[model samples]
Target: MSYEDAFAAMAAGTDEAVANALELFPSEIQTISIDGADHLLITPQNLDPGLANHLLIHVHGGAHVFFSPETALNSSLAAAHAVGARILSVRYPLAWKAKFPASRDRVVAVYRHLLQDYPANQLAFYGGSAGGGLILSSLQHLLAEGTDMPAAALLLSPWVDVSGTGDSYAVMSGHDPVIDYPVSLASAAREYAGTLPLTNPGPSPIYGPIESGLPRILLTSGTRDLFLSDVARLQRRLIDAKIPVELIIYEGMWHVFQTSTGLPESSTAWRDFARFLRTAWAID
Candidate 1:
């Protein structure tokens, strides 16, 4: 099916469909409290008995308003097996209760706690869409405070600019069947950001400074995604800063196409992500 068609199928409650689709994978789903809020965690059922030297922390996407770790189980499990790493899918605060720095701070707290037990060089951050924006924003916060960055990062169709200035916003609008464009997304961003300026790097990473010494970054986006311009702008900034950056732009695909695990495009996206993780973690 085409990306648009797949997204339509997904928008019609595909989470339930994907959950059933992923039953074959050996995995566990549960919740853990981070900063007094319940957050979800998904790990493989029989993760290699050995303590994983590497960990993958995933933040979920819902325009900063909806969904949680449970909705992303299929791709999360696939990534765990492909990379030979443990996965921690965080349940950060949503836009309704908290706002801007609240969600970002929650993830940072979890990362900080993880660092106490794992080496900084062995932990990587992964997220898609709004989650991708959070990963980058969180890194910027850590860097500003002189904390160590992750070993690597994987961003899939990141929504890096809430200001909505990206050129693709118009080009990919109706073409992207998943998101409805500036109408819903912009309104949600406004609610999540509260009084904070959308241009603030803490809220929108694309406008933030590209710090040196960050971990290797692998960004994935579809040519048809509304945030295509955001990804492109981020790529240019990171490349200019001499950061190790790799971008995979899928032709004719829409936003977060990989969310539909049953589709062929979704499989390809996951494989590429797995390969990126394997290499990043030095997994043989």
Candidate 2:
């Protein structure tokens, strides 16, 4: 089914959609309330409690309308296992219910609460799809609020431009297996933006001026991903602003294709993320 059709089905009965999505979640993961927001904490089965210094905050992607933290735990689990770090996945409000800034603020609040126990330097933020845009926008918010930024950010197939102006959106249409053009991202972007302009830095972060003190960013994309323009533009902007950036493009892959387990390319992508995290923390 096309993304638009899937979204229509999801909107028809959000509760059922959410319930079905949760089936993908690992049963062993623990759900907890953090600062009044729902969060899923996923740890390796053999993880030692004492080895909790390194934390990865995973922001899930559902085009701002579909999955919750619980539903998207599979991706977070993959990341945690790959990096050998604990994953704290945030469950923020969705756009269909609360609109743009609510979810962004929730992320900021969750990060602030985490800082009380974990140092900013010991934490990294990882997100894919819409979650990737959240990662960038949240960092922009953190900077504006004068809070210390995290050590690094990992963005997979980041949808950094809500404006739907990217060239790939036009050319990559049949080539991209997942995204379905103005209907998929653009419609959801309108719902999320609400009263705000799509180009508002708080929404479409690619439009924002990258300033100093932002966290090191590792952005990955595939040649066939519709969001390739989004990632490319953000990487260029970061480079222009002198921020540390690692850009990886998996040739012939689709959007957030690393979520597919067992493929050699997927393994390489996950390893890249783990390596980036290790280097950020000086992990041997």
Q: Write the residue-wise lDDT of candidate 2 on 1-284 in tens digits.
A: 64456656655544553453244333357776886876988776545344478788999898887777755655776677677778899999888778889999889999999999998999899999999999889999899889999999999998888888878888897789988666577778888999999888878988875889999999999999999999888888899999999999999999998876556898899889989988997774
Q: What is the TM-score of candidate 1?
A: 0.90
Candidate 2, overall lDDT? 0.83
RMSD of 1: 4.6
lDDT of each: 0.80, 0.83
Which candidate tops lDDT?
2
Candidate 2 structure, TM-score to reference = 0.90
* Model 1 alpha-carbon drift over 4 Å, by segment: 1-15, 45-51
What residue runs in model 2 are displaced by over 4 Å at the alpha carbon?
A: 1-28, 46-51
TM of each candidate vs. truth? 0.90, 0.90
What lDDT is reached at residue 143 by model 2?
94
Q: What would the per-residue lDDT of candidate 1 be over residues 1-284, giving only the tens digit for each residue?
A: 53335334545564675566467566766777767766656567656544356678998887887766766676677667656567898888778777789899999999998898788878999999999999998998888888888878999988898888878988878988888666668877887788989887777888887869778999999978888998999999999999999999988888988776667887788888878876776663
